[model samples]
Target: MIEIACDESGADGENLVGGNTLFFAHGSVDVSVEFAGSVISEIRERIRSPAEEYKANHLLREKHRAVLEWLLGALRGRAHVELVRKESFLVGRVVEVLGGEGAPSGEGVPEEVWGAFVRAGNRLLRVRAEVDSGVLVEEFFGSLDALRSAVAGTEAGEMLARLSGRRERAFAYRASIPTLIPVLDPLFPTIVDTAAHWSSPGTPVHLVHDRQTLLTPARVEWIRQRAEARGVTLAGLRLVQARSDPRVQLADFLAGIARKIAGDEATGVGDPVLGELLRPYLEAGALRGDGARKG
Candidate 1:
């Protein structure tokens, strides 16, 4: 069996609607601790930062361009990342709610249906932090009437019209679970994909993640169950302090860097060369929003 170290950036738990970051990146790496430590050491030699933890920002500086490219080249095939466009994810949840899917968890709709939902949601949604969940829900539903016009005559528009015929249903759904906004945490899918990526039918993989509050005991078990159902051996999953594990720190660097670049792309300010370097490490169904998915 193999062991993979993992970490995530831009995770706001269930606060997908209004969060601090535009993208949530879940990163996993197969490199050994010694190798990861060497990577960290190499960065220190070049950048010479005073921070105890060498994060993605250290490598993202203008003066550290060569250092960042070198690190990406060194980690080329050893790393994997799954990115979520936060606002688009919220749009998917809106579909689940309006489609009468009951709850927004795993694959709430068919592939075609999910695609339609994303297109419709993309037209109306904006990435901004809401003051509270109530405001978030209210503002989302308020935009529905106009969204119909935005995606008029399209398949996504028809789907939204049929599902959201009565806007009251959306609010009622929210009222049922006052605290939970039919949340779908992207980390679950990311972990499952990461497990399948590193492990084959016979070869299991143990995942070590940087500790996250969202990963409760029940949630960890849920991830394992999902992985097993997908025919992957998630033999074990553990949480560790990133400070103690160089492998996890390596994951941190990858996740943070990926999030930054992807965020830039979503905002229309990305560098084409850097995007090319990060393209290979992305997982499936990434950057879903507006009209299509981004690689």
Candidate 2:
């Protein structure tokens, strides 16, 4: 049996950059159990602060980067991380630029152009703030119209049209899930599938997630049913406080790190240290969506 400890970060309204992490250990002879404790201790000592403090601050500091790097190195092959992030603001910007409610009006957009639009949108959002919602909305849409007209018949316009379809699908899926579990609804099944992929044939997996009020008994049952339908052998699923479990603490750290990295990426910032630590797993395609998960 394998024990998976899961946790998520970035649920606050401003930072939609969030994801879940799974810290895996074989039920028998798992070395991660001990390694987690040592890593936690080392992290605590390095930061001169409690684990909870690091989590609360979103672990974005250069000082904390090394500890996070160490943690990632330790869990390199043992954990699976998954992140689901949506830049609604950027989506909105794209909608504005293309003269549509969502997506561009033309054909298809190249990935590079889409990326540039997102980055430019991020910069714009960052620089202009503290404005009335009504005014902001008006300005945003107006800007979109201006951009659409200016770029009409240009390469950028064509690229925006191409990118619209994909963005529309993402927005559709984002709208379907309950707002409360926007991150978890899609995440739960993906994690279960990941566990099944890593487990021995016919082995039952037990899941333990950091306690959340939203993950009621009914929700757990729903996840179990879905996993069962998918032929994933789920022996049990329960919620526990991270304080009582070192593995859960590691999960929390992983989730927090993933969120910060995602937020940085959306804003066009880079953290070389964190990037290097994650390079191996990323190259192996271990991360799902914006989060990290075992492949």
Candidate 3:
């Protein structure tokens, strides 16, 4: 028998970080598990058609539909398909905290965070399911620890702690079963959000400082120029803004560096080439440089 575990992921922010993630797994000891490949193929076809822009949310559902349809069509004549997932109730606190008021939520958090959780939950389910299906799943077992790491949210940690003991039961399986399991990546929305948040104002300046300390010398010179151009006295503004718009920041930063280099050749820091490069960023209201643009 073969076992499968699945997971998925999506973007998280305007900067485009962790967004959507999903995961699940299945296993069976039937050495001649006949329908798995066909089921995966069918799922691939359905998802790819309609030429729709594929988002992270569609994958797991597609897998489910694929498995169910294939089972009913080809294998119903032989094996009784039995599949199981742990029915984890979002605890009252989890629902209250992670989920919002009234209709419920994990809404405020980035979708990728929830995606990681789903991946972890599904991976655990896969281990249990394999045992129930009497399958020896030797591959990818080490991945379970990674799943746990992904889903362990700092903000939601307490709520998750509450879920440890409640109704964490595994399902039983029977003979002649043909199952297809879809697995996906556990998302890292927190990583993206953390980046965005750290770049925002009123955040610790040291965060940016720490990042700046790690930049290459060329990038460092680039930042110095950009900051001088903007007359920005505040620490970390250049780096934070640059992280958001690398291209624009790089151009302006380079312009600033050029002006400085020219200063060594002449008297004061002024150069037509520098002005030309910085003008667009200034006009777009995206950057502020040291001196007003000169003709």
Point out the higher-scoring one by TM-score: 1 or 2: 1
Candidates' TM-scores? 0.80, 0.58, 0.17
Find the candidate with the highest TM-score and give its number. 1
TM-score of 1: 0.80
How high a TM-score does candidate 2 get? Answer: 0.58
lDDT of each: 0.72, 0.52, 0.28
How many pairs of residues in model 2 come into backbone collision? Answer: 14
For residues 113-222, write the lDDT of model 1, one tens digit per residue: 44443433432232333344456555554455455556567665666567656556654654464221125556776777778778777988899999977677877887
Model 2, residue 245: distance off in Å is 0.3
Q: Which of the numbered candidates is closest to the native, going by highest lDDT?
A: 1
76 Cα displacement, candidate 1 (Å): 0.8
lDDT winner between 1 and 3, please give it: 1
Error of 1 at 292 (Å): 9.6
lDDT of 2 by residue, 220-278 (tens): 77667767777777788777887877777777777666656655654557465665665
The residue ranges of model 1 lying beyond 4 angstroms of the native Cα positions read 100-142, 166-182, 284-295
